[model samples]
Target: MFFGCEGVCLSFGGRRILDKVNCSAEPGRINGLVGPNGAGKTSLFEVMSGRYTPEQGSVVLDGEDLTRLPFHNRARAGLARTFQSPVVPSTLTVGEAFRAARKSHRPYLSKHDAEWAARLVHLEVSWETPAASLGTFDRRKLLLACLVMRRPRVLLMDEPASGLINAEIDELDLIMRRLVDEYAMAVILIEHRLELLAAVADDCVVLDLGRVIATGDPLTVFDDPAVREAYFETPDA
Candidate 1:
């Protein structure tokens, strides 16, 4: 099965944020979405996640159309996403956050689900700890646990490795690979951190200025001259 966008287009105030971008994530595969700042990677994610309807194109999952579905419906349709920043409710406790995520897909959170999610993300805090009380790295892990608790068909992760130590990043990378293989789901990861993306992604898609500039093997795509030019200042305009 696969999930992807075809000919997606989005603009704000007459300025294009995404322009006819196309990419796919196959089951049990990690598709890395990378670009320099203002590259519209996140905007492309918004179009795929149904946060913003695209001006043109479709969001497809296993051959079904999801372009018009709202965020909740998309989640119900087996879509889950994590933001560039953690979005766990500050008032909710560690366990509550996990429970809240599961509540959308199930009436009650099972012990197995809780343990699986907590362990998957290497969650360490007590169930009683307020989510806000955790540090940035731990907080990100907690939010990741919340999303993974649901076992969505398509996972959209935005900059999940930000603010993590080398060890934690390594753990995150391993966990992501395990999750994809275990669940057989399509995962699109938008990350600025090249090392992490290179380590986790099975394939790579490069987006620059709202357009897909390159797509293929992770190492090859990153090494493309266009990609280098986007990151490093070139003498020629």
Candidate 2:
């Protein structure tokens, strides 16, 4: 089964944010979304996650039209997401944060599930340590750990590579590539870094100014003339 948007369109104050955008994400495959800033990548994420309703399109999950479903209902449909930055309680410990995020998704979440997520992110600190005590990378990892607790059918991630060092980036790349197989979920990753996409994504779609400019394997899409122009059409001096 796959999850995605079809002909999704949206706008704000007459300025278009998405135009007939279509892309599908399937289980056991990582779908990458790459484009210049303001290319509607995050906007599309919002639509797919039920934060925004497209003016003229539907968000479908396994043949059920989720276009009008609320975000909570969408979660019940096995859709999960992570933001550009970590949003965790400063006072809560690692385990507590995961437990709290786990509550709405499952009536009871075991320590094993939390440990599995922690291990996925390579978290080494004690579960009792306050979230505020962890470094940026660790806190971000905790956020990811929280999202994976529910084992959603699809996961939408925005800028998973942000604020990570080289080693951390490498670790995250490994985790992402394996997540699909381990969890049986479709993953949609949105980021600006081409290297990350090439290293992990099975396929990618390129967007520009609210419209799709190209879609294919990550390398092919990135190499498209339109994509090159969008980011690096400037004269080589």
Shift in Å, residue 101, candidate 1:
2.4
lDDT of 1: 0.85
Scanning candidate 2 in windows of ten residues, the lowest lDDT window is 99-108
Among all windows of ten consecutive residues in candidate 1, which has the lowest summed lDDT? 100-109
lDDT of each: 0.85, 0.87
Measured on C-alpha atoms, candidate 2 has an lDDT of: 0.87
> Which candidate number would show the highest lDDT if scored against the true structure?
2
Q: List ranges where model 1 is wrong by over 4 Å.
A: 105-107, 232-237
Question: What is the Cα-based TM-score of model 2?
Answer: 0.95
Instruction: List TM-scores for all candidates, in order.
Output: 0.94, 0.95
